[model samples]
Target: MTLHQQIKAASLAALQALYPEQAFELDQIAVNQTKPEFTGHYTVVLFPFVKTLRCKPNELGEKLGDYLLAHTSLFSAHQTVSGFLNLSIKDQVFTDLLLHNFNNPNFGKAAPKSKKVMLEYSSPNTNKPLHFGHLRNIFLGYATANILKNDGQEVIKANLVNDRGIHICKSMIAWQDYGNGATPSSTGIKGDHLVGDYYVRFNNEYKKQIAALVSQGMDATQAEKEAPIMQATQAMLRDWEKGDENVRQLWKMMNDWVYEGFNNTYARLGVDFDKYYFESNTYLLGKQLVESGLANGILYQKEDHSVWVDLSDEGLDQKLLLRGDGTSVYMTQDLGTAKLKYDDYGIDQSIYVIADEQNYHMQVLQIILKKLGEPCWKGIYHLSYGMVELPSGRMKSREGTVVDADDMMDEMIVLAKEQTEAAGKTEGFSDAELQDLYEMIGMGALKFYLLRVEPKKKMIFDPKESIDLHGFTATFIQYAHARICSILRRENLPIMPDSSHFQGFVASEKLTDAEGKLLLSLEQFPEVLKAAANEYSPAIVCNYAFGLAQLFNSFYDNHPIAKAATDEKKNLRLMLIVMTAQVLRQGMNLLGIRLPEKM
Candidate 1:
């Protein structure tokens, strides 16, 4: 148990030992960190027990504090401040905790729980390259997956590629008509980028066709509906659905190009998926499930011969499942994919990393699944995150207004290089080595900036400030880790000692206040990981890592480590610094960030 938990358990035990017939769970006990003005490690809330014990707040608190000091070995002394009983813990508790984990790299990580979970993120479309919004989704999903894995949960990272639809047909149509047998190699552009160019080309050409029809005396709206490009795209979708050999070959060839580009981006972003689910394969699986729903009379058919489910009883409108022409909608594919994933992995939960715009869609989907008597419906969780807006406003794919992911990362690396070189910290480095460091710092800054905020809130990303050496940036945390390394190098101390040979901290006659404060924060790492896992928020780890780094900096500033009053004090300071770096590395690892040994 942690020190906070230990004190809480003991306080509950003390209260019951003092007053019989009183029942209290540990969670009901409110324990907070003692204020700096108070000479204690933690404080207990005593006001709630005033009426339950039939005693004044001060009187009952004093009685409880006296009992805790005398009977509990957790604390050495206690004092009542404004009805809150503050308890000072024994220093040896902190010392023992630090010694056990000072050199252990996985100190705060949990043991395997043996339960399996499936996380799906970065559901990119094959029609376009990744953009800024995708970067947010990718970072959030990757960080959360790593957090769960570090917490000892078996996680299967999956990606559902939207490789089919009218959108894909538009790009294919544009490529077929406008291209002079061009490929990624022929044009020397990325596969996804080349495909995306045709997608935009389709929009521009469609608009031209619409204006010409309007000038020719056709209704604007009707012209849009009657355009030849629109007709050809629809025909292509139908042909593809019917397994036309030419269309199928074209679809496979184009999607392969997009996947190659996507894999490169994922590699640079440090994200990987165990399985890839294609819309082409899973779109038809749910037809049977929808048929079962229809047979059970849970779903109804409209006069137009379309299929839908009436969720008005659940305060939702009827949702379309399949069209009158026997073509499946996106919802049908989702159902099939959900069942496919469950049957393949036997996962306890499936988290879909989607945007906040689809909130209503996901809710309706879960209800439909539940009404269909599917057990996996309960395991469906939509990790809905907000969009990434620029300083100007929202972006449009058809307008080509979104920031490309590759372009953004390149800009960040440039900024990282500028800032690092201006700092004049590097003494010697080869060109390749410097470039690698630039990428690490650059990508670390981007990931940390994006993941630092809560996933539900839309954030305006500023690339310039993200690489700042000060402030709450990952660069600051990296500098802290690097500082520790520099210190170790100066002292000629081994960074990782043999676990069996970890010499216990010297017998310091007395521990300083700074050392105690640092240890208290170090002890909270495991708790932070568990809380982050429960909440499914990477923001939790970001907050914890920044705070720990700040605390270590404060300790470094106030204490003299290289030359101390005694050898024992020096030993304690060294071990404390080592443990601080260990915790920082573990916490940042879960956030998909790397710490450079030198800045």
Candidate 2:
């Protein structure tokens, strides 16, 4: 168990012993790190017990503190202030924790767990390249999966590609009408970007058609419905659904180009999926499920032969499953995909990393699934996150105003290079080494900035602020790691210190304030990892890493490691910094960031 857990357990025991007639659980005993103004390492709240036992706050605190000091060697002293019981842990405990885990790389990871999970994210369409708005969703999902896996959960990363839809057909129609047989190879453009251009063209032409119809005395709503491009796209969708050979060929060719482009982007982002579900493959299964629901009286059929589910009793409106023409909707494919995932993996949890705009849709989906008596409905979890906007406001994909992911990455690399040169930190590196270092810092900054915020809160992306070396950014942590590496190399010490190096250490030796603070922070790494997993948020890991780095910097500034007054002190500080570097590396790795030895 971690130090925090141990503290909570001990507090529970003490409460039970003091008040024999009262019932207490471990979770009820709140334990938090003592504030800097206090004189302890951890503090337990005494307010809860005082009200229950009808005793004064300070009196109850004194009883509990005295019990802990007399019964366990965990704390050396205790202080009570305003109903808070603070306990100072013994110096030997911190020394022992550092000695036992300094050289261990997997110090914070949990053992394998029995529960299985499937995380779905980055469900991009085939009509456009991944833009800046998609970055938050992608990074959050990827980092959360890594954190969960590190916490010992069996995790499967899945991606559901929306490869078949009318939005895709809009791009195809535009390309067929306007392009003189221009391909990605012929136009010297990325496949997804090429398709995106045609998508924009389609919107532009559609707008002109609408305006022309309106000028001819047609109502605006009628003009939108009667637009030639819309009619053509609808007809193409019908043809593709009917298995027309020519339409299928065209659809396959365009989707393949988009897939190639998407793979390249995913590789650069360092994210991959264990499973891939396509809308084309799953929509039929959804139709069958709808038919079954109808036969079972769980769903109703309209007069036009369309499928509907009345969720009025569940506080939701009627939902459409299929059109009168037998074509499926987005909900249909989603239902099929949910069942397919459960059938394939039998996972205990199915997490969808979607934006908050789909909150109502997800709610209706779960209710409908439960009405159908599907077992997977119980496992459906929507990890809803808010949208990522820019300082300039929201982006519109069809109007081609969004920042492309590739362009953003390239810009970050250039900015990194500029900052590295300005700081005069690029000395002693080859051309190839410089390029790799730039990519590491650039990508690390991007991912860290996006993941540092709580998932449910909307954020604005500012490229310049994200790469600041002195701020709460990945660059700060990466630089700290590199500093530790530089120190170890200059002292001719091994990066991973051996236990024998600290053989002269005495457990009874007193610790400096800086040393104790650093050790305390190091001992909390395991607890931090567990908290991040439980909350399903990478922001927790980000906060821990940033705080640890800050503590290390403070420790180094106030104390000298290599030039300590005693050899024992030197060895102790060496072990502390080495373990700090190890933890920083592991923590950043969970966020898909790489720390270089020299930056």
Candidate 3:
């Protein structure tokens, strides 16, 4: 149990003991970190018991505080302020915590959990390359997976590739019409980029065709439907569904190019999937489910022969499952994929890391599955996040205005190189080491900046602000870790110092305000990790890491580890900094950020 949990448990026992006739639960006790201006490590509210016990707030706080000090060694001192009982934790609590876990690598991680989770993210379409918008989704999902895994859940990172549909056909058709049969090798462009160019090309031509039809006096909607490009795209879609060999070959070739490009990007991003589900293979998967639904009268067919489910009773409109031509819709494929995931992995939770725009769609998906009596419906979790926009505006893929992920990464590295050089911290490093450091700093800045905000809030990406060393970015945390390492090296101390070095220390050893605050922050790492896992938010972890780094910096400035006034003081400080570095490393690793030994 965490310190907060332990405190609550202890307070409950005290409350129950004090009032034998009145029943009290753990939830009735509210424990929070003491305000910075307060003189305690944690504060307990006394208002809940005030009314029931017919006692004043401060009176009740005194009763509870007296009970705690008399019955337990948890608190060294207690003070009543207003209606709150602020308790200072015993110095031995922090001393033992530091001595036992300072060098433990898995200090904050939990043991194995019974539940398994399949977290699906980065469901990128083959039609275009991943853009800046996709970065948030990718980082959130990846970091959440790591957090969950560290929290002891069996996590399967899954990627469902949207590698089919008219969008894919659009690129193929464009490649055939406009290209002189140029391949990625021939054009010296990344395969995904090459395919993405055609996707944009198709849109450009599609707009022109629409404009020409409108100029000839056709209604805009009719012109949109009757444009030659649209007609050809529709035909190609039908042919592909009907198993035309030529169309299938072209589809495979283009999707292959996109996959190769996607793999490279995923590698550079340091994310991997345990399994990959392709839309092409699973498009027709829901047809059987639809048949069963129709036979059971749960789903209805339109006059045009398209199958649909009426969700009006569930506060939603009718949802199409299959088209009149018997081809599956996006919803249809999603239904099948949901079942496929459960049948394959028996996951207790199926988390979909999709954007908030698809909130209704995800809702309908779960409802439809539940209506169909599918077991996977209960496990459906939509981790809906907001879109990422630039300072100017949102990006449009069809307009060829989206910021490509590769280009963004390249730019971040360039920024890192410039900042590192400007800081003049590149001494004593070879060319290879400098390159690796640049990549680490650049990628760390990108991931941390994107993840520092709550997932549900839309954010604007500012590259310059993200790499600032003194800001709440990964660069700041990384530099702090490096500073700790430098201190340890200069003092000739082992990275994982022997706990025996502190054997001469006693429980009554006085801790400076900075040392006490740093120890308190370090002790909360596990609790923070647990919160991150439960909330499915890496932002929590980011905040914790930043705070811990800040606390360490304050401790370093206020105390001297190598030249302490006494050997005992010096040993205590050494252990504190070593543990800080270890905790920082573990916490940042959970966010997929690397900490360098030197800046």
Candidate 4:
């Protein structure tokens, strides 16, 4: 067994032996290598066993520490404070774990047999171009899937497009009226952005029509009816539903353009999806489910003939399944999508990465799916994260105030390029080289900034703070890896270690504080990965990367791996440094961020 596993096993064995009838089950054995004002390389907690042991906290901790030290070679010394047992492992044991990591590149990705999991996010509407908010959703969804896959779960990444809606018809109406020959290229705008502009233009014209009617002393409802934009949009929707050839062709054309633009951004961001679902296709499928529900009497029709499900007892209002005119609502399409996914993927679990604002809607979905007799309802998870708000307030698309995703990416690239120029790294770089590096740094910064925050907490997106790459940022971590590579290159070391050189390396009693701490941090990576998987939190991995980088920086400031007096100690330290680099790379990969060889 590995050293960590051995340590945990020894600890567990002692606990079981000391309290024979206490039914001690090991929950977790963390390595809190740092104490507030103490001396220890690892602190373990035995609080969970206190109830069964029926002893005071201090007594229980002391007994466990005594049991572990006497029975196991895992710790050289240990102490108990309150209910916590702080144990320092033998230096050789810690070094052995580092060597193991150095040998195995995929140190933290081990797992049992994998199971299938479905993940869905980035459900953008066809009416408008994707914006900065969609970037958050896409990044989280993509990163979560990577982490789960790394943890040995088979993941299916998917997205849903809201294609058939009133908002979409607004774009179509404006295109028909004022976009006779105005293509995206002709107007020097992206296809999705161009279509979205027309959507905004339609609203503006409709508002003018409303104002004109209001001046004529008409009420708001009358003014809305009198507006030609509304009439045109309604006519387009009718034709779209009726499968009119001209309308279908135009819809396909516009949707293709928007999708092309979306794909380009997705490529740049290093995000991908295994499948796509469209509301146009799923809405009809939902109508079928609604019909089935009505036939089975699981759903009832109101006096107005609108199909509704009563969930009032669950502290939720009755929700509509189908409108009086038989049009499917948002819930209808989601219900259909869930059923379809069961047949297509048979996922063991399905997670939806959505904003916390839709908590109510998702709850309703879960309940409705259960009432509909779907077995997978119990397995559906709404991985709700809080909003990414600006300093001013939340973004509202209807007000034309949402930050466009493509524009934001372009701006980030520009900023990255400017930084590269200021750093004087662009002197010998070609345009192609500059473009590649800019994309890496730009998207890396963006993804890291979003992933570093706790997914459920509301975060303020400050460009000024995010662009600073010196501390706890993607560029900082990437720079650490690059620095290691530069030093290794100058020394002409092999990429992989020489096992002959690794055996019987001499110890250094004169190690610096930072080197010791960094070595300690390297040993906790496997445990960190396991914790991240267990808690379903990418922020755990992010925090680990930040801590590792900080420790490595400290070591670089104090110790020189290249100029050490002893080759044995120098090679050993370099091995630890390489192991640290691998951990950072692996962690960043789980968050869907890449490391550039140089910066």
Backbone clash numbers for all candidates listed: 0, 0, 0, 0
Tell me, by lDDT, which candidate is best: 3
**Lowest lDDT 10-residue stretch of candidate 3:** 461-470
Candidate 2 lDDT score relative to the true structure: 0.90
Misplaced by over 4 Å in model 2 are 462-469, 500-508
lDDT of 3 at 259: 91
Q: Could you tell me every candidate's TM-score relative to the true structure? A: 0.97, 0.97, 0.97, 0.93
What is the clash tally of candidate 2? 0
- Rate residue 496 of model 1 by lDDT: 58
**Residue range 549-599, candidate 1, lDDT tens digits:** 988888888788878787778777778888888888888888889998777
- Model 2, span 1-599: residue lDDT tens: 88888899999998899889999987788999999999999999988777779999888888999999999889999999999999999998998898889989999999998989999999999999999889989999999999999999999999988888889999999988997788888988899988999999999999999999999999999999999999999999889888999989988888888898899999999899998988888877788888899999999999999999999997778999999988788898888888889999999999999999999989988988899898999999999898987677787898776878999889888888999999998999999999999999999988998899999999876644544555898899998899899889888877787877667676556898888998999999998999999988999999999999999998888898889888888888888999999999999999999999998
Q: Please write out the lDDT profile of model 3 over residues 1-599, one tens digit for every residue.
A: 77899999999999999999999988899999999999999999998888889999998899899999999888999999999999999988998898888889989999998989999999999999999899999999999999999999999999999988889999999998998999999999999999999999999999999999999999999999999988999899989988999999999998999999999999999999999999888878999999899999999999999999999999889999989988788899899999999999999999999999999999999999999999999999999999998777788999877888999899889888999999998999999999999999999998998899999999776644544545799999998899999989998777777766567765456888899999999999999999999999999999999999999888888788889998878888888899999999998898889999988
Please, what is the whole-model Cα lDDT of each candidate in the order they appear?
A: 0.87, 0.90, 0.91, 0.80
lDDT of 4 at 507: 60
Q: Give the Cα error of residue 247 in candidate 4, in Å.
A: 1.2
- Sort all candidates by lDDT, best to worst: 3, 2, 1, 4
